[model samples]
Target: MSHDAAMSVQHPQDIDQGHVVARYVSNERRYLKLLGGGFLRLGEAERAAFIAALRADALQVSPEEIGALLGYEWRSRLTAAWLVGVARRIEWRERVGELLLASELTYAGQGYCFALAQFGGKNDAEILVSYLDRYLPHLECRYDQGLALGALLRLDSRLGTSHAERFAVRDGLWERWVDALPHTRGTADAWADASRSRIDAWCNLWDA
Candidate 1:
């Protein structure tokens, strides 16, 4: 046999082992894309299988590879955070921290912070708190702050709420916002106007 052909050959027992080597451990975009439309469109059994396979593959990837996802597209970032959270991938938590610090404070950034909370212990929560301390002053919109606060509450309830005084909109206000979010649905412009009005009110309250 040619050397290449010889290398390709495997014993029956070795075939299963060889298949394992071919399995994906990273490149999340590729795996999720290969699932066709997305995980949500899959049937129940297939979705579970896909999730299980992704979890297994996530666990196999190096911390560095997982960390790299902090800088990737939103889907990849969310996936990385989910994997880190479930796997308790402590070694990669620093990368999540970088995401928190570098975040643009948009909806996408809020999701990144939310996913990051799933990864570590008290110290990780503390890091977020500290970051928020610095982040609060320059914040212009309430949309992202609402998401960040919710994640912090998940992290450490007492500590997170302790900082509530610094927020212009209290939990009660957010509760009201959620109640109001659905009413503006029929018109996109109405939705935007209402959202802008609420955001402005929150900003003005904080500024005052």
Candidate 2:
């Protein structure tokens, strides 16, 4: 059966209940065409439907399709990154890291790297840190370097003293965190206030 036909066979109720495998398959196939064809006028209901479909099984996105998306323009890459953010599969996380590290598409690569850092574990952290140590100086944007720094921080938080001292000495990252603090809005008002206090405490400890 045709892709759209198959997707049509899936009950909308099934989609609402979180059965989105078929929908994702159909969407992936149509992504390029949808964009190129200028079908950007999806109504609220359709848009909501699409987002629900995406969230239902983002982790199931195949490596090949992910690779294909990495090759898309920056906007599409951002969409792919959002999908990765919702993904729960470790294998997909590994594949995302591999693609980001190897890709020449810098925009997508940066987004993928961020997603990997957000979702990845010790090995992903180690690989990313090693890559940053070697390549960060060559990166043009301070923002991009900051993202790598954030990833390192997340990793360090999990690894503790095993890697914290190493990160503490990374002047570029430490400086950037200091620079970024005033600009961060935090996760929410209460959480932001608490985080600010915690950060202040950490700063005080560093001074000591």
Kindly list the per-residue Cα lDDT of model 2 for residues 1-208, writing each as its tens digit.
Answer: 1111111122333334232323443455534323321223567676556556655546566655554544444445544664665463455666566544544343444555546555647876776666555444443333334455455555566566244345335354334344445564232234324433432332222122
Best candidate, TM-score: 1
lDDT digits (tens) for residues 10-95 of candidate 1? 32223232222223323434334332125546689876676676657666766545544444444445555555655666776676
TM-score of decoy 2: 0.49
TM-scores of all predicted structures: 0.51, 0.49
Model 1 — which ten-residue stretch has the worst lDDT?
1-10
Q: Which stretches of candidate 1 lie over 4 Å from their true place?
A: 1-43, 71-75, 104-111, 136-143, 157-208
For candidate 2, the lDDT comes to: 0.46
The regions of model 2 sitting more than 4 angstroms off are 1-53, 57-64, 139-143, 161-164, 170-208
Which pairs of residues have clashing backbones in candidate 1?
none
- The lDDT for every candidate, in the order shown, is 0.47, 0.46
